[model samples]
Target: MKEIIAIIVFCLALIKGEINSEILIVSENNCHQVFDKDQGQITSLGYPTFSSSNSSCTYVIKAKKGQVISLQWKDFNLPAGHDRLCHGSSDSVVVYDGRQIGINNLYTPMCGNHSFDITSSGNMMTVVLSSTSDEFDIMSFYRGFKAAYKSMSHHCKNMIYKTGYGAIASPHFPMAYPANLDCVYTIKLNQDRVMLLEFAEFALKPVKGNNNKMAMDDCDDYVEVYEGAISQRNRYFRHCGYYKPHPITTGGNIVHIKLHSAKSQLALYTGFRAFYYSGVPNKCGLFYGTPSGALTIPVIPQTSGINVECQFTIKSPQVAYYRVRWLSFGQDLFKKGCDENNYIEIYNGFYDKKDKLLAKKCDTKLDEFDTQYNEMLVRFKIEKFNPSRNFKFIYIGVTNNTVKVITDKNQTCTAKTTIVYRYSGPEVISREVKCELFSIGGLPFWASLLIVCGAGGGGLGAISVAFCLIRRRIRARRRYRRFERSDSEGSL
Candidate 1:
């Protein structure tokens, strides 16, 4: 009687189609399916049995509202697809978000031994499998894949790319992307190479006035590119309302790209596609804003006898002026003339040689420079391949709109900078001018000035009371000050 009961149980298992792993995912006759079970197994046609050749099917998985579908592969084994053969001779599988199966909707194609988790952006996802080649004697040859799906929730995280080359597109390229996206992707290269980016397709929300400015004042649905991390200091490029953008080459090894769609963006639009690669970086750039950190110019490889020169321009908006502080300069440049072959030329305004000269300096050990103007140009020319040009600087922005003027005759600054460098009698660039660059509250410069004045030379009354004591020190220091201000050749 016990043996009879055991035989009956075995027959019942076979009758229910519980073979292989004992859980039938899809029946043999029904390949196309809509999976409504919250969590269940999904597999290829006749999974764990055999997948017929040249056969294909699609499976749509839907989760509850406000929840996304998540898929994880347990087993995946299929004939490899050859890219060189144009996918004609092998079998493959594709997983994508939403119900559509178009060019832009695909995740990376899956074949030999790949198991990963894919979470949809919405509540629906589709998976498709196709078999095209029959290399074996019979059509029913290999067992295919096994995966599980369930409802889940997700959040967006910042992406960092370390690959040497790759392509990145907005959520669903060529199709209207979802609303209210805020994503940041960064590409970091090795020390020897810098990042180069080119945008193939770009169409953000249009500007209100139909302006075509690359550096837009007001941008909503926009893209921003920075040479470093996303911060007020590294922001140099921001664009909106354009079809395509010019290629960008970074001065350093890291590049950060940010894509933002405002909460007000109710409608959807096809976003953008960009490609990036790492390569040898040559010099030249447009640097904006105040830097909280120091920047070093990276070196490029060249033959022995070549002289490579590069120039970069720094500019501020109309409301601010530049405050430059060279960390290791005043001590190195105190008594020496700049080198002729490998020297830096500083111009008063934006134009390099067309504007009046500020200083043809070789070294500026540690000093403060307030360019009471809105723009400045810097040119670095060095002969032969030196690993470093020994140039480092911190460009800053001060929220002031006026140029400092003691007298109309002493410091005559205009569209072209004019300085009274000629010693008509005993006139010199005074320490009082240096104080003007660093008078902010609790600043390092102000704190250092306090320490210097509060010591023995408390000939007090500064900025108010100590202001007179500061003048006495300026009179004592000017006798030995370098006459760099007078060296400019008037107007260029």
Candidate 2:
């Protein structure tokens, strides 16, 4: 319950701050650079526009100790001729989990056009862009890739990662985890996909009794793995030993991991390290709200999932105003504000004419927006997937009488309200996000209880019809099951 509260606290935070009106493009000389700062952006030569062929760049970011790095590819584009399979593509952008590039560090080598997010296990992350003569086309152009990096000091407790595959560890691995620490890592994937986990290292405070005897069921520090929505009965296994466990596999789309430590052996046990990957993926046109969450359009390794078109309608409660927040961005091109290609629109009251435009933007700076009525229709578009998610918008239920913060800096937003792109792919994303910014005070935190949970959202209000769900973690000392042995560890 405490973890649930912490995650929602940010969703209710007042969206009050000055909005920056420009997009800063880094210079070409900044390539092959090493950053030890807390946050920054890396771009390939010319950004927000195409550059000459054969231009490549690389960047490495290192965070402070006890911290990890998070990345979001806001813009990623390549010439048409370079669109080939991962192994066959001549022009590619690769991301590594560590400071250097190698087979073990390779996360993904993207060739065509794609946008997504990544989180590093330790303190460093690497990005490299390369192209050859086969990719150079006198008649074609490419924008390369742009990404934002920030230091993540939180060990990702109660954080929801919908990117499908990534690495997770106790707050700061290799170093001893602090005492009385509790955290949860959740991986949500498409229902069709299964997941697997292989622990590279594992250690827990030993509960050695007389003669240095260890008990398997009895533990001081431990890790718990769950199959679905982290309920006591849904637990797959619990471990409190020091040896690396066998690879864990799950039969469902979502997996939950919980970690706990006592104060007795803070300096002795270094905790555990593990990597998780899944085979499934998108939430489009979906009407649901998990306090504050992002729009997750999974990167389906196939050619079909790369192209996207999504729409949503966020509405406020009877007497509240609808709101949206940002968790990431690619490039909000200030110079070429909202265009027919990429944009976002928020409306209050009637949709046809009486609607008030609360916010409007292009691939430029999007902070937060609230409506003048009890509901708002939100429309976000990108003629092509921008390679980085725009911003994770949250519905902060603000009172209707409060001072309005958003305004319609109208620039022909109405002129291009309806657009038809020249591509076809993710058509199922025509969801209506009608549950955000509304009062969900009575709703439970676990998504399993919300009706939209099936469609990848935790909702309230109308969703409260769903009473108590089967899946729930009661306390810090959640009930769990034990795996028999390493070789026999199995999926739920």
Candidate 3:
């Protein structure tokens, strides 16, 4: 009879799908997911309801460190053929594990639909989205250009590039050139030569190159056509140089400059303006630039504790390439692990300089940057600077407005940039004034005060509290010891 009963129980266990499990997790709705610890196979857990509504319920789990967690849900509801409730069906819950860090779904995965796995397995313990596109995160990639371009170009016969920031709706709006320069222009990468250029009131004839060639007047406006290898002496400049030069030609249009990086890291930067010899100051300190003919714009001192920011419009008719490089001079300035390269090279979006051909690259996303250092040089270049086909550079990554370039990056660092004109034309070069890092946390003042106060009141309040707690603990321990001794003696 006992054997028969055991057999019946075994059959019931099989019917209920109850197998010995290994790992467990508490779900947002208090449902439990069971799987083998070794194999990581989900034995049984019915369909999960993914909620995106802000006021959805939460589930709590009691677990230890080093446990793997996952969520199961879908992006859409009713399999695409059902009803009027399709709007809020894709909202999901993102679980933040208190202990070990790993991927957590912002929403549950759709049935049978894969690839939306957002993993975050870092010690930082932050539930940062690893999957699903983050348009804002791309901006951080461009901070590498903090040491490249200097100031506005003095040969501003017709073109001006200025940095502007604030709350704005569209990516291309809110862009304004420096007020000091006369002619202001916006370059867009488009199929039809649609570019914009305004003539400065005080137009000066450009100095001729040594070849006695007209050195290309109004050439700065057509940076899209100049197709050649791009290079810069400043290693930390943000703009990545291209092996092939691209000049501008299309007028009233924006251009895209995509860089390819295969093996070595690429530093990309872009800015406007070039400083002349008269404005260049004789070198006095590492942080100061020489006087060049161009007026020196005083470098802004970083106001610590506040977020400093700058937003520029990247009106490329096509997709554009962006890169950033920075010079690290202060302590704690080294790249986390790489000692060989003094500067950090970060590619903001898609495209690598290492590719054998530019055709192999594609734009994954578009975004802008924020300044991150106390002082930095900036250099910005598109495929070309103009509308006439005489210059060469690809304004658009593929075609025109079908794609767009945007800047979303900002910084709290001070900046002083100088543009070097190749002779007396708008063809100006760039560099930046170095800056020193200052602390605004008031930690030094507070630390000194703490030391002084403690020295004066040494062993006073702390000792008093310590003694009281210690006595109480000791009395309790003594009473327990005495009881134990009395019991042992009485037993004897």
Best by TM-score: 2
Report residue 273 deviation for candidate 3 (angstroms).
32
Please report how far candidate 3 places residue 275 from its true position, in Å: 39
Once fitted onto the true fold, the runs of candidate 3 whose alpha carbons sit more than 4 angstroms away are: 1-115, 121-492
Taken over the whole model, the C-alpha lDDT of each candidate is 0.58, 0.56, 0.24
lDDT of 3 by residue, 91-182 (tens): 32233422333332122222222212221111111121111221222111110000011112222232322211000011111121222222
Q: RMSD to the native, candidate 3?
A: 29.7
Looking at model 3, which ten-residue stretch has the lowest summed lDDT?
Answer: 164-173
Candidate 2 local lDDT, 1-492, one digit each (tens): 655653343223312211111222334665568888899888765454343445567788899887778787778886443333356555677777777577656665676685457777788888887766433342444556777888877555786666555667787566778888788988886755655666666777755752123444577787887656676545545566664543544545677888888765647777886776654434342333211123434333432324455565544332235455543455532336667756666666547343367677554444665555545666666544533533444454432123322223232221212111111101121222223332234454454335444444444643444443323433222434333343367654
User: Candidate 1, TM-score vs. the true structure?
Assistant: 0.40
TM-score of candidate 3 to 2 decimals: 0.18
Residue 104 lDDT in candidate 2? 56
For model 1, what is the alpha-carbon lDDT of residue 98? Answer: 68
Each candidate's clash count: 15, 15, 137
Candidate 1 vs candidate 3: the TM-score winner is 1
